[model samples]
Target chain A: MNAGIRLMTPVALLERFRPLFEPRGVVIAGASSHPGKFGFVAAHNLLAAGYRGEVFLTNREGGEILGRETLRSIEDVPAGAADLVFICTPPGAVPELLRTAARKGIRAAFMATAGYGELGEEGKLAERELATLCADLGIVLAGPNGQGIVSTPIDLCAQIVAPIPPRGHIAVASQSGGFVQAFLNYARKTGVGVSRAISAGNCAATAVEDYLEYFADDPETRVSLIYVEGLADGRVFFEKTRRAAAKKPLVVFKGGTTAGGQRAAASHTGALASDDRVFDGMCRQAGLTRATSIEEAFELAASFATHPLPRGPNVFVLTTAGGWGVVTADRISASRELRLMPLPADLRSAFDARLPPRWSRSNPADLAGSETRDTVVECLDLVASHPEVDAVVFLGLGIQSNLGDLERNGPFYPGHGLERVVEFHARQDTRYSELALELERRHRKPILIATELVDCQPENPGPATLRAAGSLAYPSSHRAIGALEHLWRRARRSTAA
Target chain B: MSAGAPPAPSRTLSEHESKQRIRAAGIATAPEMLAADVAGAIAASREIGFPVVVKLCGDGIAHKTERGLVRLGLADEAAVHRAATDLLAAARPADGPVGLLVARMIRGNRELIAGCLDDPTFGRCVMLGIGGVFAEALADVAFRLVPLSARDAHEMIDDLRTQAILGPFRGEPAIDRDAVATTLLALSRLAETSPEIVSVDLNPLVISDGRPLAVDALVEVRGR
Candidate 1:
């Protein structure tokens, strides 16, 4: 029961805000002269992004803003000046503002402020009054506490601030301001950009669930990521999430699992994080992948950006060192609930000829350390072509000690085989790049590379080769598993639909 | 021949009969008399107890909190007499009788709510939620189409925001899931079986130890 209840609300909030964000232009009432105010921030962002439609600003004694003129109230703003008015003022002013806005032909509002329904008794009355005003005037309000919104590339950054670089496939909606910004940074570094980033703060009038329905239809967004504290309606959210998952890759991060966290989350955002166990069951049934952290969230988003989703879970690890291969295989085996089969019988004999006798030639197909770039390429080709493996991971040795200076020393210290080792790595890097480019054309599967060294150079074939496949993050094996899991789910969802 | 059949009249009950019918349905009650005889009322209270809750319990006091017909925690015979006098004065029944009810004071940490309303379109519907301030503050409640199955009743108990309150949290014993389920089931059953009941409200159903005991209940029945 706990699990099911918590899972329902975030989805409900998302469903409620669908119409408010999709309008041609949303006006910010109480469009402030103050520098740090939400009204000022939202207006400045929208205008700078080249909003072509009407943007009417409202205040008590309306006049010119930074450049645009403000109306004497929502009533003074000419009818049809805007489709929606965003109230960034205090809750006390909201009822009157809503009353005036509704009279002047505004049909929707984004109440981007807190202190109502979240601040206890007095605030609750204020919230009820505001609801009454909306009901009377037939206005649709997005929030009494909301982070506003931003639709990328379309030049719609209604949020107080925009942290995303206006490009990418992933669209995100979060309850926390901090989580939303963190994801923006994470996506950029991972080479995955955002299509839209919004924070549905208190969801007084609209919720995250509303935007989800729009995102399900929005062609610009391919993968949808959600970070939630809670929702207003659980069953509505559950049904919508299930429907959205069928169309796009939907990944969610739900906070407030711990009792202390739930209490804090409630006080912070007025979100009731129902029960964790109930939420878990909902995610499973909806086919929505639940990410454990911010890192996993972005990694999963990134994985969906560049790779063809894996169908089932057969992963093959091909490497030059047995230890690296073993660790890579172990990570995948441990993290994924799927089966990782041994290499097929046909590829073994061909795999043996390229490596030295001392090489631990096993399922990972460890090409002897002394092997050249050609051997690495051959192993990948064999591994990728196999019938059993659905995904392939190549482990690259990206760093090697400089041997020129050491050659003067004894056999042990001298670049005894330093130059050869460096050359081997350099060749592997070049060959791997070519392999990555060639594999891109296949499109039937995805192959990723991992390495220990943080910096990969042209002189190092391993690093350069993997870099061609995609970007890399060091010491994030868990992130890698998250990536694979996302791709697998994304593919399965698309196929299942 | 079809036009010859007479239309049925709506059924309505006086306040005295409403309380009597509700008490007969396995619900507890305190001593009280609707008769204008002060002697009979005094006699009933003596048989009951010293401290008690007194209310006008009239059909007109729909929202008693606002109407000022409610007096709580009255102690001793003198206080009971004063409360009864105050309730009678507020009712302003100079012509004949005044309706009043005296109930035992119920104490508990948690307050839960159960309600049923007959929707003009959907027929009967039931609502269950955390009671008291949080119910209105959070709106953390669940609604079901009646008559609710055992699974539906359990889901309502499981889905609310403060569902943790139902379980033993913060050193409290787990709420009797069976009782909660039964209460919801009974409410649904009432809505289904008794078409005369227009709406029912059981606010602050106290959960002591593990069982939820309804201390206060009000039913709105249809009139003929």
Candidate 2:
């Protein structure tokens, strides 16, 4: 039905989205004095997150919220005072307020009001009226029952949510507001930065496809993460997602596959496509990586943000222990896209010359308890530069530091050269983390680092160092292998396209 | 079919009619002929070769094998005549002017299924899967939206879990992927052009000498 919107060019779509994502100023309509109301919380969050733009709040009864004075009506504000408006009023007041805001040159709106579309037939009719009005007014609408939007480039957190995430290159868009917040919370817990994020609640005026198309050409976004429950038009979603994937990696997680889940989705989004098999086929055809869970989706997006695309499927596994190597090799063998290549003679001989006599000189190249400070990085350089290897999964990062912990806690701590040894161990671990990123950039291949992160001490230098360098040390070998497989699939799809 | 007219009630087409429609779309089908009488059936079988298959065919007779109206491996003219006579006698009045279908009996080790359906969300979609008696039980299949490109056809074929069967299996050569892709592409075009066609099912597309031949098919159309 919205055929004209689909025909817009990517450049034009970017400009259309600019006022919503990069607005010069914003007006919070229906601003409340109560702390629990969304009207107050949205303004509080905008001010707390340090939004660097002119913000004007409006209430029917003029008052002061936080510190800014509220106007009696949106008409009291000057024309061109703000380009975006945040509506926290009831559903009945949204249409008239939007009309007034449009007259004042506000081209974008985000509605935090509920009680429409998700209620029933009457609610759906009301939702349709709002969509028609917004279309006629030439305004880009985000949601009628949505949470909010975040733009890190402008240091904007114009939402009713808490915890503005650190700035990075991964952009998130989801049909569920909870998922958008969950991804951002994970970003904060980890050190991954977010460029922009949105929760497309009810999606009455703007669908998830429009956001995907914008992210495709957004210079700040290197990867996009999406969580979808249903779609209004599967073909349009496929086309836009395919176009986006051709430029950068797009990771998707689909919900509502089972019968019970499908019923929930029908009520949740109002239009459900129930065939998971067809959805899987669409993913492969469109070159989008389908993640099985939320954690996997985030990890895949993180991998794309931090690492380079692997040139091929040939993977090399390097481990300090025999079991980690064996498990990693098994996982790679089970994968459809990755292959564990046999170690060539030249590379094997190079490892033999550098490593100790008891090394297990095979594909895994188990260190056999023989490792010095220079051993890991030297062996990594040898394999990563070789023509036979496309990616490397280096396991067991905190081995040396683990031993250092014991000596520091023991009786001889800092007594006879123990302090110097502990400091050297920590510095070496951090250096290793930084060097991995450098090697990945120099060789144009992915080098994933894995260590035990669960129940890990907060002061563990290996993972903390990786986080500081804007890289991730995967918690297990399986996760590392999974991220590497996604990189390889993206590279293959890019080549095919 | 007129655009403004209401759609007619949907019904199944006979096996022979379905094969004819698919063959016209550049898909290979088993060489067969329709006969009205026992003598005509015997002559058609002889022209096709010694060993053949015969079935009572009509629009109303959808499940012939289940109804015991199908005869397989008729090695001679006498067998074809007896089978044709018995099939004709076995048909009920509700079958409505049934005829005997005589065709060559082809043997193959590998079988694949290909078809199209009008999905509610994605419109027409082409499907490829492992086919045989266990097709429903195995449930190994992949799909793509209609109007498939050559690359899409190949990728859908590769998407199937039965990759071993696509290669050399049980003393047979590797299945002809190009031939399979051509069949899928043709079905895509047929689905795109024919709005009245509701669904097309080509089960057990038998691979004889590395080439897929549509030994049996059923096409559902919008009108009686």
Candidate 3:
């Protein structure tokens, strides 16, 4: 019943990796007392996140570590006590420990150790043996050298980092440890929480496609965000990813698009990215959306998760600043998929009642520096409620610091000082969030916001407010319009498939 | 698939034989007969109707237009005879004489090229593109892996960069899109079922009124 997608992999092999995604009982090999060590932190993450399963700590000394009794050897742990083993030992010790894991019948592994295949030929042999032994033992491994894994559905945070982003729909899996780390951090900053995130380093026994297959079935995951520096098996990756994308959105951010990036990727993950144009052709056939950068990838993920699918090409641009609107319009005009709508007669009358006489009423309705909260709400209602408009993009609405100048509009300020001014602006931010959510909910159209306020500013509540309300704000109008374009294109591609 | 390694390319089929092979696969090909003499050419012209097209058809004789071996819009028996004599004499300087390929002249504003190639990485794939004089000048083409479903055929036509040509243009009725899709589907089946036919090239897939008629074709086969 699949439309043009190729299904692959043996059913048994596919099932073997399930424990890696949702393990019931996990144990840490080489669990340490030292706070700085990876084993200690990996254990700490699980405990901190309140993982709802049995967690075992194995140390050679057989003492208590992380308030749990350590198992001196694999034999010390009871039979079938652990379904997943996180091997944190050096490369040379991995072979012997894997033998014990096989005897113990641990179905899955998340190896945190480094210095394996990625180092050189000798290390490659070790990685190859690791793969062969796992296969021989009927075991599926996440990595021989990896950052770690996070399963938000099971409340399992088994990575070295703790306090991962709050639970949400987007699932991320990538070969670059840095990309996964950056994604998780961005998720927290933007409140774009992840269903699951994996830094699939080296990928010896388990490949990237294995995680794609897992996320495809995860009900919590609405879309899969993949960062690719290179692919181990282009054929299998294409087959599985296309199949996954056919079911849901698969937004791919390819790192090795340039010669410099390709070399860096080779050194980082020991992978040679495919030729740019050839890889592009393959993605087009598979119906996958390609984001040019990690930021765009996350922006697109959040946009898709928040907005309803845009059904037509006509887009309504509402901007507080005319220059920002023109810049965004220029960017939108570069793409053929989206178009600027003519100013509807109803919209003209509505804006005329709210704004001064100088408003440009042609197509992209520029508010001409009216930062008033009522102006945005009325414009959003008029544009989103219009029959011909498919999506509305708002620009330069987050610069509420303009409200601090008491001479300009000080009467509106809740009486004096920078602190009161901030409180007043926060109220405006909440109102914008509510207005955006209400309009989108009623109209079933996408609403993208742009702000000039610094995302890192402590006083700025725009990004967090919008994020909490299940919407997102871009730092620039270009990104906001670009994300809207991608969302529309993604919806079309999904439905067509 | 063949029994052993794929055979080497020997030569391309004559246009007449190529048309016959593809027409057997359910493609609507214009009727044509190869004439060896002036009398035979006139007879073929009479049988095919008033205006006829004449071209020198032979193995390894590619790009007959630049070689000036093709004559179109020959209106009568005298015109057909004169064109056939010129084409037959032109064949002498080339890969030698085969015959004068005579067929009913087709007049259409839009031209398209459709073909199949055994791509190295993708295997058997079908290609559809805007053709005629601008084929090489503008490579507005789209490719799809073969055993093409109806949807694939439909998408393949829309995938062309110069999309305006597919619709009603120059006051002519819109080319029958369903027939074009059927042509692609039939060609895909021909490639999949016939392993000996390694590739095919049908240029000037003339859109006359609202239908597609294969005016010229070439099929490459294995072995000498």
Q: Using DockQ as the measure, which candidate wins? A: 2
Pairs that collide, model 2: none
Q: Write the per-residue lDDT of candidate 3 for residues A123-149, one digit (tens) a residue.
A: 777888888888887778777778888
lDDT of 3 at A276: 62
Which one wins on lDDT?
2
Give Cα-based local distance difference scores for all models: 0.66, 0.87, 0.78
Q: Name model 1 segments beyond 4 Å from true.
A: A1-23, A47-81, A99-108, A128-140, A349-360, A371-378, A397-441, A451-475, A489-497, B1-224
lDDT (tens digit, per residue) of candidate 1 on A273-377: 755655654565466777888777776766665567776788777766577777767777765344456767677777767666765556666765757547766
TM-score of chain A of each: 0.78, 0.96, 0.89
Per-residue lDDT value at B118 in model 1: 49
Q: What is the DockQ of candidate 2?
A: 0.45
> How do all models score by TM-score?
0.59, 0.96, 0.78
Off by over 4 Å in 2: A1-5, A409-412, A454-459, B1-8
lDDT of 2 by residue, B54-166 (tens): 99999998888789987889999889989999999898999998899998998898889999886666667889999988788989999988778888899998888878889
Candidate RMSDs in Å, in order, are 14.9, 2.3, 5.5
lDDT of 1 at A34: 68
Q: Which residue window of length 10 is worst by lDDT in model 3 chain A?
A: A1-10
